[model samples]
Target chain A: MISSPENTAAVNIHRDDIGTRMGIWLFLFTELLLFGGMFFIYSIYRFLHQNEFHLAALELNVIVGTFNTAILLTSSLTIALSIAAIQNDNKKLSVILQIMTLVLGAAFLVNKYFEWMAKINHGIYPGSDLLLSKKPGEILFFGLYYVMTGLHGLHVIIGMVLIAVMLRLTVRNKIDSNNFVRLEAAGLYWHLVDIIWIFLFPLFYLIT
Target chain B: MENMPEQNQKKNNTGYTKYILVWFTLIILTGLTVSLAGMDLGRITVATALLIASIKSSLVLSVFMHLKSEQKAFKVFVLVALFFIVVSFVLLFSDYSSY
Candidate 1:
């Protein structure tokens, strides 16, 4: 019996979730390598300029960093829960959880903005004269701090966008139980963003 | 082999309470790491902080990312990527530690 062309195509798509996962995992590996290179540079610089890095870390506000850590961690939990909600076919709860995740993410960026503003106000940014005149070790430490955390902030923004889109799709019923791979993939991306910050928290704010 | 029937039956096996538990543990670990920084443990602070961070991230990855239930092939792919991260760290640090 010859199945209709549409039916065959539908079956093929349904059967290839693993391929979809494989593609995303490959993409995630490349991301790992990208951040891994930055970390390599960070380690070498920290080793050579341990004293400067320590003093530089002292300038960071541990309170704000700790708050942002809690915020990001909460957001991670929300996103993971959203995936579970959708898998159980609770579309409304899933959307609510995603929205919650986005709010937590926005809160994190707001906190980060205040932190960076405080630093930039003091001329602590990369290439500022006050920073430029410091020992090269100190300069390198702050430079890596801004670049690593800034890159991480960018990831947070991207994760928010992904969650926003997924939330919209979930609302439209485009991401229900039968087609939740999209939601799952976005959750993985969001978790990676949190994982990066997990490491970043200690290196920047607590290493003093 | 992750047959088609089993794949179709796949749904998240984790309970909602587990996510909360993980989050609580992560928050407590963050507090510990921050407090450790203030105690003047010298170099051990950095080591202890990173060790806790690793533990926290492992929970996020294994549970939240659903790596524990993922196929063995994908698990290997992830492990290989992590191996490269370690490789880059060790080979580069070997050259820099003496300088």
Candidate 2:
């Protein structure tokens, strides 16, 4: 059987890097449209209630949002660098960069926690009495705010878990310079998360 | 070792310089957006914010996400997805704008 040409071709065809990558890209497109639908909803609501959206946006801290944006962008850079490091056969550097990406992701979430905490302390969370007492437009604004940012935050956590798995694979030599598509896929996911925040930051925290 | 393909030999040789440069550009864009938010852009405020965000996201898509180096098929798929998204936005907004 080992000598048969049919089995040889079958074995050779078992690994398809391009196919794996294309699969992830397809998954990413679905992710994009998922958030794109939310963005569309946000735009319509903002258009319907421009003044309330503006006023509600002002309640958010621009400084915190900008800082978090910077952190995510930096994480994108670090994850990209990690891919480059792994490609260039610098395993140690790749792992370090992956760790840096995780740290930045954690920092972004930590900032988000504090921001949400501040809002919650002020009784501005979803379905809170203070929020319910607000105008309908204000309620919608905060409602979208919590849903959109909360979903993006969830993606950040998922991306970190994916990266952590890739890190373990790298350590075990399952993903090395010769076969780093897993790491690349993980990086792509992280970048998508960052891209989502890129739009979310402005729509929610800016444009006031 | 036997399963590694020839494509694996053609590793993604992207350097760190490009990533760092993109990172800096993104930071500057973030600063610009924040500062612009303070101005009284009126009706164009959301447009401006969105335009800048689009620019930043494109940069991330091309550089960080490796779309620039990806296959033509990937690019075409992205364009198709984006076209559908644009269609949805235009269709939805047309309804809202139609009185």
TM-score of each: 0.94, 0.93
Give me the candidate number with maximum TM-score.
Answer: 1
Stretches off by above 4 angstroms in model 2 are A1-13, B1-12
* Predictions' DockQ, in order: 0.74, 0.74
| Cα lDDT of model 1 by residue, A154-195, tens digit | 999999999999999999999987778898889899999899
lDDT of 1 by residue, B1-99 (tens): 556553344654436888889899999998888888889887588789889999998999888888888888878988888888888878897887778
DockQ of 2: 0.74
| Fnat of all models, as shown | 0.83, 0.88
Give lDDT tens digits, candidate 2, residues A50-122: 8899889889999999999999999999988988888888899999998999999999999999999999999
- Where in model 1 is the C-alpha error above 4 Å? A1-15, B5-9, B12-14
Give lDDT for model 2. 0.89
Chain B TM-scores, listed for every candidate in order, come to 0.87, 0.87
Candidate 2 chain A, run of 10 with poorest lDDT: A7-16
